[model samples]
Target chain A: MANFLGLIQNENMKIYRRNSAKVFAAILIGLLLLGALIVKLNAPEHPTQDTHWKQSLQQQNTQYQQALTQMKDNDSYQNYYKSQIAINQYRIDHNIAPDRQMTLWSFVENATPIMILVISIFTIIVVANSIASEFNTGTVKLLMIRPISRTEILLSKYVSSLLFSLLCLVVLFLFSWLIGGLFFGFSGGEAHLSYINGAVHETSWVLATWQNYLLDAVKLIMMVTLAGVIAALFRNGGLAIGLTIFLMMGSNTILALISQYDWVKYVLFTNMDLNQYFNGQQTRNDMSLGFSLIVLAVYYVVFLGAGWLFYTKRDIKA
Target chain B: MGINTEPQKQPAVKLEHVTKKFGSKTVIDDLSFEIYGGEVFGFLGPNGAGKTTTIRMIVGLMRMTKGNIFIQGHSVKSEFKQAMRQVGAIVENPEMYKFLTGYQNLVHYARMIPGISKERIMEVVKLVDLEDRIHEKVKKYSLGMRQRLGVAQALLHHPSVLILDEPTNGLDPQGIHDLRNYLHELSRKEGVAVVVSSHLLSEMQLMCDRIGIIKKGKLIGVETVSDFMGEGEGKVRFTVDDGQSAAQIVKQKLSLDAASIESDAIELAIEHEKIPVVVDTLVVSQVKIYGVVSVTQSLEDRFLEVTGGKSVG
Candidate 1:
């Protein structure tokens, strides 16, 4: 077991020592910090004026009171009271508590797919290349002849790639947070932003507090693991990363087309993100949690298993 | 897995009709030989003549197409772990992580072999005389230094048998000389069975106790340096009076056609007793005998004959 651990450490050192990987990691961290700084600096201040709904109600109340006050001289009190009653009745009928129409946590919940969509596309390249580079450089043989089992070597690579992916996410989140906070502020207001009707609206929804960054890190790890498995099984980093991006991007289109079939939702990439499951979003096609979990497990197993089997049985002569 | 109850073992390595093929090409064809305990046995063969393939099979890197290889009486196929436990090998080229320091590479390999100690690593470092440069990364080391480091790594576990394939491939003349002397001391003083495979006959002729010549995947011959020199093993040569008459007289008396008369000398390929008989016959024949000398066949002639005059480059 110690020998195995030593081999794993050696494998990890090889990855960490690479100049290109180090540069990539540094760039990611820089981008994340930059993004966070930008967001922090550019966040708009909350509107100081009264809300439109509140202003409308105030205006109605003022108009009604003035009319009643002038009715003693003009005999308009009864008509003015009737008008106020009519206005109140209209409010009641329309149920216009528009004051309570702030963005909810539910909005952030629905946006989990977008979050995974944005991050995983970039993650595919990092994860895939981490393993595929060994094959490309003919360094796999050096690692294999160390009396360590193939499974251990593959697992070490998988774990290291996962760490790299999480690091990338950390960089991105740090930059996004800094940027988000710079334009916005450290305050939770406008944690979620949306563009509707050519106007950018700040949402009160706050999904990632500083503490939730850990969970974000774990989620990034899971995504990278999926990509790492694909990378290890594929010929090179490019194909693995390209295919992973294709799956993430084409997932919605595929789901739309496959929704006509009863069983297709179980395999959709959008459904694979665990946060999506918690959100109670409707699938394009109905898929039970049990079924999706099984499918994902199968995929994880096949990807990991195929990588191990191929690496072990491969001719290391080259 | 019982120890051979026999009191003493004859040889450290023995290959019994070991045949191996890669696809349709026979890389090693029905090879059989032995290396006795504590001797530097040289395995001489040309490029693509199955030296590397045989070493790989012996080290359990590749399985044989047929037959078995035994190290210290443990079968390479069936008892590989046990057999490998006693044997150390560096086949073809010696390569290590250029990024790792010499000490790091040695320690890494040391950890793989069970029961290896840090002290053992230090010992090997000193043995290879790389103590000063051991901490430097391999990429900074010269070719000779790297080869020494390779030998150090292979010897770290103190395996009884060391197999080196073309150990001097990339070294300068001084480096080769250093290696040759070092290997000789290791086998002679430490009593380790060292098997060196090379195409250079002169080195083997100088270094090996006995040699096995392989050609086109076949073990063509195995002979002691003396036997390989043929019937001229310790026999005296004669520059005698009337060299042709001496040859005729000796051949007529002994009834053997082993004497060849040159212009100046007669080479009497004779047993110890025949030397006395030849001198008396020449004296009785009234031939003016000028000199009596012993000539042995050169290593080149022996090598050429053993390899059947096959081209070696």
Candidate 2:
């Protein structure tokens, strides 16, 4: 285990020692601060809470119920309206506010999705070249001659790339929270209404925020793994990074087009969004939350397995 | 360099019928050889003769299609880590991370193996004579400096076997001479078995204690440097005022064949002993010999002779 950790350290040294990695870190922080500034500029000066919010939410739920009665069962927008009504009812039942507050935690949560995508892109760009760059520079010859096994070498690169992504995420989370607090006064952030399993429940804001970020990162994990496989197979960094980024940006449209078929549920992108089950936003009814998790797990194994097989079995001609 | 030491009984590296194939093409035929400790083994072959491939297999960068290699009595295929722990090799080029400082690159390799201290890293840096610029990035280094740094990295763990493939490529003349001396010292004093591969016979001639010549993916022969160069006869050149007269006088008086004749020189196939007799006869016949020099039969000449005049790539 100690031996393996040293390998990881060596791998991390190669990663963070590159000047581009420092530049990426600086840019990620700058973007987070800039995003908070933009929100600060756009926020309303004062927020008002309605005294009769429960009565208003009750009227909205009645309107939502009538709209649902007139809509088709498979209407894509049905889930959105259903979740909204349930969350509103929960708020009124618990006598909690509607959570339309301009606060630190709210801003942190809202910024997470975009920032996660940015961080994913940065991580992908770095990892795509991790294995292939060694071959390109002819350094793999020396690296492989070490007493460590090739599997361990490959694992170290994979883990280091993930660690880089995690570092970016933690930085974004903490910096966004601090920046949002400076702008929004860090109040009214305790209430977090969560819609789960066709019911609404009040959850802790910090836990909810972390869950939101992690769930949003599922696709990034899958795409990064795919990038690693491509890198191992082709030994070409540019091709791997380019193809994975294209697939990532185009995944939604691709899924929408094929989501009508039963097999589409098994497609990698379709199951990548584990949040679909939690957010009441799934496009297909064929896959349950357990089913998506299983599919994603299977794909993860396949991706990592393919990478291992190629990295270990194939002779390094370079 | 000091006197060449005799190779010890224990072999540090052994290849038994090792073969490598790429797709349907065989790159290395059934090759078998042993490099004993305290000796420098030279691998000589022409272009496309699988020198690089064999190095890769020995270093575990490439897999052999058949047979196996043993380093310090550990099978490379079955006990890869144990086998590799005894070896330090630069398979082809001594390519380092140009973005990293020389010291950082050494540290990067040091972390891969256990029991290497910071003092060891510094010691290696100093040994390679890169201590002055060890903190500078490798991108600023010369090719010779990078080669030295590679040697430093390979020596950090004190492995019993050191393999350098074309280690003299891009090196200055002084650098090559220094490396030759260093390799000799490593084999003689430290009892390390060194394997060096190159197509340049001149470099191999001075540096190698024993050589194995490979042609068309097959090893033709392996012999000590002295025994290999001691074959057949040597050429003697006669620089004279009249080359035609020198050739005529030498053929008539000494009965030695004048291999070729230039305007002011003549070359003769003669034994080392007959050189004085030829010089005496040339002088007696008033040939006016300006110079009589024996042209040593170089390894390049011997290589050509053994390979049947096939070109060296």
Candidate 3:
């Protein structure tokens, strides 16, 4: 176990020593600051909050109730209206007013989607290059001739790539929180309201935001894993990077076109966004959270299994 | 047979009928050899004779289609860690991470194994004479410096079996000389079995204690430095007067059936002691003899002769 940790340390040294990885980290930080500045500059400094938030929420509830009644025949799409109505009714009963001003947590929530995209692109490149560049530079010959097994070496590289992504994720979360607090006042409580099982529950915004970031990052995990495997099996960094990025950028379009088919739920992209269930959305009627989880697990195994088998068993002529 | 009671009696690396094939095309065909401790063994062959392939298999970088390799009595196929623990190699080139400093590259490999310390890393750095530029990135290093750094990386673990494929690829004359002395020192002082592969015949002649000549994936001969050079034997030539009659006298006296006269000379394949006898016989027979010279065959000539004149890469 200690040896394995050393291997991971070795891999981390290789990853962090490269200039490209540091540049990626800088880009992520720069983008977060840019986002904060954009939001700060575009907002009205002295904007007044509406004092009648309860009344407006009540009025919004009535409108949602009316829409629900009119759309009773379309019961399949009623969860959206039902969730909103339950949240508003609970807010009124509990005397919790809806946020009318930007707060620290809320700004972080706004930056999640865009920053996640940048982080995913950066992580995919790191993961892909980690495996292929050894072969390209012919360093793999020396690397494999060590006392360590290929399985351990490959696992170290695999884990380090994910570790890099996790580092970026943590940095994104913390930096956005800091920037958000500085730009928008930390005036609101770190409480988030959610409607589950027909009840509105209050939860820690920290936990909720972390869950949100990680759930939205399901696609990133899948894509980076794919990239790592492709790089290992093909031994081509550029091909892996280009192919994985193309698939990531085209995932939504590809998912949309294939959503009509019955087997679409089994496709990797269909199950990547595990957040759909939490958000009261489903791409298919049969895909529950459990089903998506199972699908992702199977693909996760296949990708890593193929990569491990090839890395350990295939001859390294390079 | 890398198992013997004596510490230096057994082979450090033993390959038993190792074979490798790509699809139906065999790359390495039924090759077998043993390199013992305290000797510098040269693996000599022309290009594409599976030298690199055999090195890869021994290092566990490639799997053999048949047979097994053992390093210090550990099977490479089963006890890989134990086998590799006894070995250190640079398969083709000393291709270190270009972005990493020479020190960092050493650290990177050191971390893969247990019990390698900063002092040991520094020791190897000093051994390779890379202390002045150990902190510089490998991309800025000269080819000779990289080769030295590679040697440093390979030596960090104190391996019993050291394999260097074309170790003189980019080395200058001085660097090559230094490396030759270092390898001899390692093999002699530490009982390390140093396996060196190169196409430079004279370099091999200078550096090797024993040489194994391979061709087309089969070992044609494995001999000690002296034995492989045919024991310095060549045709003894006699530049004489009446060469035909001199040759007739030598043939009649010494049973030299193949000795013949050409260009007013008679050449006989004989040893040093027999030259005096031939001259005495010629003089007694009243045949004039002017000069007697022995034309010794060099390693290059013997290598070309053995390999059918295909040039070594």
lDDT of model 2 at position B89 = 87
Tens digit of lDDT per residue, candidate 3, span B26-72? 88888888989888999988888888889999999889999899999
Model 2 per-residue lDDT at B272: 79
DockQ of each: 0.15, 0.82, 0.78
- Per-candidate TM-score, first chain only? 0.63, 0.93, 0.91
Q: What is residue A47's positional error in candidate 1, in angstroms?
A: 7.5
Instruction: Write the candidate numbers in order of decreasing DockQ.
Output: 2, 3, 1
Span of 10 residues, lowest total lDDT, candidate 2 chain A = A71-80
Give me candidate 2's interface root-mean-square deviation: 0.7
Each prediction's total of clashing residue pairs, residues at least 3 apart in sequence or on different chains, is 29, 0, 0
lDDT of 3 by residue, A11-38 (tens): 8888898999779978988887888888
User: Can you tell me which runs of candidate 3 are displaced by over 4 Å?
Assistant: A45-78, A88-97, B1-9, B237-267, B276-292
lDDT: worst 10-residue window of model 3 chain B = B1-10
* TM-scores of chain B, in order: 0.79, 0.84, 0.90
The per-model lDDT (C-alpha) reads 0.64, 0.86, 0.86
Q: Model 2: runs farther than 4 Å from truth?
A: A46-59, A70-76, B1-7, B237-268, B275-292, B304-313
